[model samples]
Target: MNSANLNIRTDKDVKEQAEQIFAELGLNMTIAINLFLRTAIRKRGIPFDLLLDAPNETTIAAMEEGKRLLNDPAAPKFSDMEDLKAALDS
Candidate 1:
């Protein structure tokens, strides 16, 4: 069987990070890429789950609210468990 060259363009940092991870997993870049391709072929799609890792709208709003409360001088603060429980029960 004959092998052909496959060239891919990627960011330098991305390549370096991938190389480091592959090295830790006992694979070179070439072998790691080949494994990915083979798995894709066998699975009829990409071998891993693709996800959007950014915070959702609700999470973003909650984070913003938390930041606002953290900066507000009038925000409630609990010094101990009893104080926290009393505040919650009110």
Candidate 2:
């Protein structure tokens, strides 16, 4: 396959940081970029699947609070949609 050179300008600090990391793994910037581009082309998108981790502390705390409210034994239970709507409308 014929390959052409690609040049791009990026943030110096970010590039330096990435360079350091890749260097540690024995990859230079050019090789890393070529590998990434090849992978993306082969996959027809970004090479890796992205997985979202659970949200940060505030979000987790709010979710826990919601769970506690939903599971509270003393909390009034809604028997049906009408009851739930009535509870919400009050």
Candidate 3:
């Protein structure tokens, strides 16, 4: 079978980190890349979910509220489950 050389450019740190992971998994970079290419070809796209791992607007607002509560001295602090239940029931 005839093969062609593929040249890919990436950040040095990223390449080093990936190389370390692949090595730990008992695969060299070439084998790992070929496996990815084969899987992509079989699936007609990337074989994994690629997503931006950022919080949504609602989640961001909730996190900000949590931080505000954490910093506020007057925020209610429940010492036990009963206290929490009482606070909730009131």
The clash numbers for all candidates, in the given order, read 0, 0, 0
Clash pairs for candidate 3? none
Local lDDT at 87 for model 1: 85
Q: Is candidate 2 or candidate 3 better by TM-score?
A: 3
Best candidate per TM-score, number?
3
lDDT by residue for model 3 over 38-88, one digit each (tens)? 999999999999998999999999999999988999998878999989999
Which residue pairs show backbone clashes in model 2? none
Stretch of 10 with least lDDT, candidate 2: 70-79
User: Which candidate model has the greater lDDT, 2 or 3?
Assistant: 3
Q: Write the per-residue lDDT of candidate 2 for residues 1-90, one digit (tens) a residue.
A: 787888899999999999999999999999999999989999999999888886999999999988998899987887899998988999
Give per-model TM-scores: 0.58, 0.57, 0.61
Whole-model lDDT per candidate: 0.95, 0.93, 0.97
Model 1 alpha-carbon drift over 4 Å, by segment: 54-90
Tell me how many residue pairs clash in candidate 2: 0
Worst 10 residues of 1 by lDDT: 70-79
Model 1: per-residue lDDT, tens digit, 1-90? 689999999999999999999999999999999999999999999899998899999999999999999899999877899998998999
Candidate 3 TM-score versus the reference: 0.61
